[model samples]
Target: MSFIRKRRSLVLTSTLALSILFLSLIAVMVGLLYKEQKNAAFHGFTEIGAKLSAQAQVSSNLIASVAGAYENKQNPQAELVSSLQLQLNAMIDDDNLTNAYYMSTKQFEIDGQPNLITMIQSSLSSEGSNDNGTDYPLDDVFLDGYHRVMTGETLLTHAYSDDIGTWISYLAPIKDDQGNIVAMFGLDYDYDQVKRELSALLWGVIGIGMLAAAVAIGILFFIIRATVRPLGMLAVAAQEAAQGNLTISMPVTSSDEIGRAAASFNDMIHSLRQLTSSIKQTSDEVTVSSLNLKEFANQSSQATQEITIAIQTVASSAEAQFSSSQETQRAMTEMAIGIQRITESSAIVSDLALHTSERASEGEQALRDTVHQMNSIQTGVLHATDTMQELQLASGKVDDILTLITEVAGQTNLLALNASIEAARAGEHGKGFAVVAQEIRKLAERSRESSDEIRTILQAIKEKTAAASAVLEGSAEEARTGTELVQTTGSSIQSILASIKQVSDLVQDVSAACQQMSAGSEQIAATMVEQEQIAKRSSTNSHHVAAASEEQLASVEEVSGASEQLRVMASKLGEAVSRFVI
Candidate 1:
């Protein structure tokens, strides 16, 4: 069913059929050879039998005695029969003759009618005794041969079979000294021996035929395999080509039909490969173009989106600008009304500033007196801080005196301990000295205790002195701050007096500046009204631009979709082409 199997089956079937035919031809040839061999064996046996019959005729006397013995139903001379039988046995011993004998025809009466008795043979018995009256079968061929032999003819019998086995007999005539026919000498050639030789030759021919058939079958198997192998390869290549792999080509090994077919198949495959490659390249180009188009569409869409956003921002800014311009126009009208009211208030404020100038001059003189008192207090506080620093130094000197007194007491205690040790060494005589050393030790102890109390009292005085120095430094800093504040107050009062006089002059200038502000506000209002109209037009134009951008974005989206579809189609085409190996 499959291509390769079909091709193989075809080759095998042809080979098998050819083998059968070859075997048949061999069988027929062998049969013919066997027949020819059998015929040759038969002819050779007939010739041999004829030759032996001629040899047997050398003893015509012995053949006559045996024949006469059979005719008279009497035993022949044993010596003469034995000598002839020995000669016949010797002739048969060297060849495939079953018996060498004499045969004769006799006439006898049976049932009062004359019947010719034929095929009467006188042979040596199996025991090598002379037997002269052994009768053979009355075969028609033997009877015919007997008639010929009686007429002084030598005859060779056709092959025939009886109980003694199939044979061809050679019959030769015997004559008296007168040379007339009397009896026949015969040699029986074994037909079975010829058959055995033929059978051996037939077996030899059969062996040779079988060997030839085996060799032919072996050669044919290789030849058929070689013939159909390319066909199988081509079938497989075709199947692959059908599956879109067009890369296979067949090898052409000869100039025969199969080779030519293989060359053609290779050419077809090459053409298919080229076509598939071209298709794949075209598909790739289409895919690339689609991708580029899609990218462009995407860029266009993004640009439109950006443009729409920009326009929307511009429209919003324009709307806000327009609202700000309307508010500015309203603010300008209120500013004009306030400027007129301020012009009337300016004359009244000028008289009040003149009156305040005189009161500020009086306040400046009182602040100067207070600044002088604060400076005096600051000087006194600086002096008290100096005095407290001197007291802290005196307390440090007292602490140093107390340290000297404590050192002197420690020296006295050491001297008293040394004196007490010396007095103890003196024993009863140094008892007074010991009592005096003890009193000195008590005095040194009291002196050390007094010095410790004085150091404590000096430490308390140093603490109080440090506290007093801190309080004086703080009081001095406060006094300096108060002096500076009073001086600043005096300076401020003087500045206020000068400012009151300047305010009187400024009040008059304010009335003139308000008039100028009102005229400028009116001009600004007119300009703002024009700007507001322009902003409103700008907002409307921005809205139009944004709407156009939105429409352009939608168009770009459609183009992007078309590009995407084209890309998809190209990709699918490329994928389809890519399935082929080439």
Candidate 2:
């Protein structure tokens, strides 16, 4: 059953068994005492009867004279009976013999067998007996004593019962002048009085035994209750512990086993409480980590999407740049052909020289258009460079965030390590917690590794973006040089028109300037091609970075999920431990 009940039962059973054993022992001792007292009382009565019988021997002469008179058919004088009664009366004492008398035996026939008759008796009798001579019963014990007395032997009866009362009779033989046995003197003691005393003693012993049993029962009850009381408290404490209330304190009243067990129980509860508190703290940390990781994952995902869009824009810009470079090359080829035609006309006629001036004007206008296009290309390159710089800044910020994440992961790992150590210190009870700590440590390591990967990708993106910016700047400078060359070509064209009257000398110069403009256009096209290739590479790197970011984000999400699970597990553990009151 319940612990308290079992304890109480055990104690009660032990007490009862002991009490029964004690009572039985006391009963045996009392019975023996009563038997001894009974024997002593019987012995005392026998002694008193023998003493009175000896005292009656003093009247032996008178008793023999009376017997002689009675045997001759002569009535004994009243004075002899009176004298015998007076002497016997002197022997009679209070609380001793009940009767003392003398009797003379005579031969008679009974059923064809010889028998003895009492011819004379003392006049004295106990207050309860008849004074007149009366025949005594011929029982075996009485006859044996009487015969022994007739043979001059002193005898005591073995206590007999009759109509008058229970008694022990003692007999002493009366002798004649010739020393022959003629009569017996007897004394009877009241055995009934001894029986009453013994009965009283027996009752007293019974009363004492009953009192002892009662006292024993009371003492046993007190002892059992005192012993069981502590156990009851312990049982209550255990019940409270079972109900998850560890706050109970037991009183250590003694250095007994129960007290020691209570102390140990309290210690256990305290330890469990500490472990629970640690688990709760760890759970809170894990929850915070999960939230932070989730937020970081979302931010990283957004950053990657932004990077993807930026890369797509850069790719578009690079494609436009490639197409623009091709157009510039085509325009340069067309300008070279026009320059060849102008050179051919210059050798043909001076009258054709006006037409040559008009062609030169048109060529100057084309050169101005080329300058404007080059300026526009320079502006686009600068704008793309600025955009790339902004993307690089963003990547730098992401790197910083990753660094922070790595630091957090490291801190979390340290915390997990500390927790694991504490769990190890807690021994077997904390094995589950140690496993949880190990899992948390693993998650933290994974997080740190993921952060490292993200940092690496950001570093690559930063390098690629820087390279792309430098290329864009170089391309812008080349475009500016091309614009200046186109402006110089336009200026040379104006001067050639002013000197068209002496056009033949300036023809070679004009051809050389056209070739220079063509070379500059080719250089500009080469620069644009280089810028486009750089932009394409930058776009590819950005795409790689974006993909890596996505992967890192996924890893972060996994870490976050793991952290969340860890948090939940810790919470469950805490809740489980919380069932204890402590």
Candidate 3:
């Protein structure tokens, strides 16, 4: 009953439910069978009563026909009445009837109503003693059967309960020799006796059913227990696992669903064991890694502080370098401008010297043409008076050419001297300028000496030509020498022009180098300015980075503490899982 209200063990509940159901079914079957058997027994008992009624009816007809007892109505026949009573008692005894009796078809008036009278009855009849004539009331069921039997029908009644006992009745017609139904005979059956026998049989069946049900329940209990035992073990293992004992493994005894469940449980336990082991290892690793990370954070913080200080120092140095570079750039720019002016001045002087040399060469060429004309004229005039006049004109032209060359050499020497002084100011940047200036000065000096020699030779030629034709031969020789001297002087002037050009070229190169150096110094100044700004900004940013590193170091310390706690938890988990038996 408690199992019915709440959950119980699987085997126990199942056995009880199945056993009860079987017993109830057997009870229902037995009840139905007993009902049918009791009904049929009642019917058989009624049939036996009918047969006895029929025999009593025949005996009555015999008495009526042979003894003429019933034919003589309203007349007493003692021997025949006794004989009929004795025969009815014999029918009652033979059939084990509650009573047997006969009733006349004739009605007798009693208490202002005509009623059928009991003609005869057995010793068992409770109708006031074995009666020869006694009034009897017929109820509906009895009345119907009585009328039917008087019409020569034999029948039985359904079982009914009276004051004495439960009973069924049989009715038959008694006929005389004239074939008229004179009386009807009835016999009552003991219906309760039939029910008693059936009740006994039903009790026997119920006893057997109870024993069989008990045996079946026992068999079912064993079967269910076998089926559920593994499940019970699985439940115990599950409880252990719930208690943090993951090491337990259920033993699998069968290949059924419960056994497979047990095997799966074992696999789960193994997986959990492996997972917990990994957690422990990982916690240890996390602890070590946290310590390392904390140390790294501290080192990084210190390095950040050092970097901040270093960046401040760099910023100061960069500012100083930037100021120096600016000064250098401005100074170089001024120097470049001065060098450029010097180069211009050198170019102008060289151009003027070159123009002077060209003019001297033109003058020398003009003198040669004039002298050749004179020689041609003189050859003819060697015997004439105008030859000396032509020779004197040629000598004058030669003297003019020599004076122009000397002046050109003087101007070139002055310009070269100026270039040498300017080159000295430019220092190493103008070394080429200095070497070219020295060469120009040497060429100019040599040109001036050549010009003086040419002037002396030309004066001698002029005087000798003035002595007339006697000295004409000597005059021609002197003119030829003067011509050679003029040619040599022209070569010297050309050399001076070339050396001046070289000086101009070298000055240009020095100017360009100075300009390049100026530009380079300016770029260096710009780079230094940018580097100074970057260093200042870097110093500021380094402070921020150092602050962040301090924060990071603090976070790393927290992580180290948390990792230590995690290691402790992992240790506890390992200890918990170690309790189960695998």
Q: What is the lDDT of candidate 3?
A: 0.55
* Residue-by-residue lDDT tens digits, candidate 1, 1-582: 486687678667856776676677667767876786566556655565555566566777666766677678776677876676656655553245667776565645556544342322334324554344544455677777877777777767887877768888777776767786666677777778877877886787677667756766666667656645664565566556556666777788987444554565565456445544654564465455545545654655555555455445555686655665555445545545544544444444444455455545554555555456545655766787788789888888888888798778867876785676556546678899989998998999899778865764564455445544544554455455544544543453454455445445545554455455455555555555555567657565555545545554555555456545545654554565566677
Q: Give per-residue CA lDDT, model 2, range 1-582, as digits (tens).
A: 486687668667756765676567667766876787777556645555555555556666777878888678777778887767766665554564567776667655566544454544434454544343444445667778877877778766787887888888877777776888877777777888877877887787677666756665666567556745664565566455546565666777775444554554455445445543543444354345434434443443454354335445545676654454455445435544543543343244333444555555665555555556556666877898999989988998888889799779867876785676556547788899989999998999899768865664565456446645654575566456545544553564465455443433333333343344344434434543454567646455444444543453454344335434434543454454455444
Please name the candidate that would achieve the greatest lDDT relative to the true structure: 1
Question: Could you give candidate 3's per-residue lDDT for residues 552-581 as a string of tens digits?
Answer: 334334433443443344344334334433
Q: Candidate 1: where is the Cα deviation over 4 Å?
A: 60-83, 107-125, 147-166, 172-180, 192-197, 200-208, 211-215, 235-245, 251-268, 279-582
Error of 3 at 488 (Å): 99
List pairs with backbone clashes in candidate 3: none
lDDT of each: 0.60, 0.58, 0.55
Residue 525, model 2, lDDT: 40
TM-score-superior candidate, 1 or 2: 2
For model 2, the superposed segments whose C-alpha errors exceed 4 Å read 1-33, 50-91, 102-134, 140-159, 170-185, 204-227, 250-279, 287-565
